[model samples]
Target: MQLSVLDQSVAVTGRTEDASIRETLTLARHCEALGYRRFWVSEHHSHPTIVGSAPEVLMAAIAATTSRIRVGSAGVMLPHYAALKVAEQFRVLEAIAPGRIDLGVGRAPGSDMRTARLLSSDPRQSADNFPIQVRELQAWLAGVDLPEGHPGRGVTANPMGPSAPEMWMLGSSDYGAQLAAHYGLPYAFAYFITDGQGAGQALDLYRANYRPSPRHPAPQAVLCVWALAADTEAEAWHHFSGRERWKIDRNRGALAALPSPEEVALRPYTPAEQMEADKLRANAFVGSGPQVAAKLRALANTLEVEELVVITWAHDPAARRRSYELLAREFF
Candidate 1:
């Protein structure tokens, strides 16, 4: 079982008015040393909670710092960027990192509708054009032939990779499945979101309708689970509790310093709030090493995914690193 580790570089702090931007590049080295398979960052805009606004830029930094582990964006919101530009940007990164880049693409803005509109107001070519955008990116990456002397011909694309970045379809819906099959690309489902559908049902749909392409014939699947681990189940929950508060507050439109896991479990919640937390966070894995391992194992058992991708965050840097280390020891 490959334990794929990834982070979104959320704001982590206990007291600062604003979460300082901690350099996760150094942390990526630790992740590599700890034997994580990948270190992926996510892109978000105008959010107080996350600091990963430019994931490709961050991935390049991490790639330069570490020689082995795969690095990439959990996904770049494709609708807001040009396929040609993204192809060029990643091709350049691939030139540096070579075999280490993984390009996960998504259609989400990672923000609300107002922000989404502000990011890309072009009505003619925006979110609704996801399929076209993906196809364009695929063509650009594969270096598909263009009309003679076409401007698109000079894109200098490389579809396959040692240095070439592998492409992944990321989504919370069946929409991603269709695109992955159509492009014959590997698909990574956000278990964080699809828990509403049950992993088996979505995984079943993805596998059954998959089309074999030169890039992927086996219908590769990845499941994303939130994880936190510690020495003892109690200690793990203790550590995870604070982070849960971070989530709870974020969901409730309240924002402040990141919470320690211990803070979450030790704190009291109203009955309504506790139920809300449970419903909102049913997909997350928060416990001691063994406890987290069991939760992850059950998710894998149910999803039967090809890879288990852990998507987690912390408010405190030390706690964050320890959490990942504990998870690696038990689950990886």
Candidate 2:
């Protein structure tokens, strides 16, 4: 299986948000050295926990700092901006790192409804236009003429070159699967977002309905999963306490920075909260390097996906880096 990374630039308690962004850059270079296939960043607008709001901007920084690793957005929220604008930005990124950019796009707001409205140029813009936007973006990125009668038929994305970003459809639902299959583009299921719910159904739908396109003659699917690995199984669970507590609190509408394991240990969990935490831990991939690798292999086999995009969150940035490092050693 091909291993990749999807970093959310997670904010941690007692650290400035800027530090989180810098850590993502550092992690990208680190992952490259570890022989990972790709390093993708995420987009989340005005989010307290996930601070990676501008994936295009972050992609540029990562491209400049890393040589071999493929850099791209886990996605740019398609509904939030103009298709041509996104295409142009990615085209420029391709110019910087030809044949190494992957343009993953999605329809989700990536923020609260109100914040989404602020990001949209047209206040009345509907996500229903996402398919149309993706079609236009695909044409622009490929330097092909838009179909007749289209409003952006004549306009072009600037800095057109021999290479273009590889476009991938990203989502946590069936709608994205159907759309991706229709376009014959690569699809990445957000297994982390829904905690594996609906993943099998979505991937099944994608491959079944996939149409052949020039760039991708066959269906290409990726699973983005949340996992953590440590030197030992017990140590791994100890660090997992922070993420477990955060998940429980997040379900109750709390969007705080990731707390340290020490902080989480100091506070006692209610029985109800403990139950929720246990559920999360049970479903999570947390253990020593070999153990996590075994679980990852089993998941890939069950899902029939060749590529696994791992995303890890920890209070200490070093731990996050170590998680990826250990996984890379096990796989690569």
lDDT of 1: 0.75
User: Given candidate 2, what's the lDDT at residue 327?
Assistant: 98
Q: How close is candidate 1 to the true structure, as a TM-score?
A: 0.88
Across 240-303, the per-residue lDDT of candidate 2 in tens digits comes to 8888988889999998899999999888999999889888888999999999999999999999
Candidate 1, residue 84: lDDT: 79
Write candidate 1's Cα lDDT for 26-52 as tens digits: 678888999989888888887766667
Superposition TM-score, candidate 2 onto the true structure: 0.99
Q: Number of backbone collisions per candidate, in order?
A: 12, 0
CA-lDDT, candidates in order:
0.75, 0.94
Instruction: Kindly report which residue stretches of model 2 are placed more than 4 angstroms away from their true locations once superposed.
Output: none
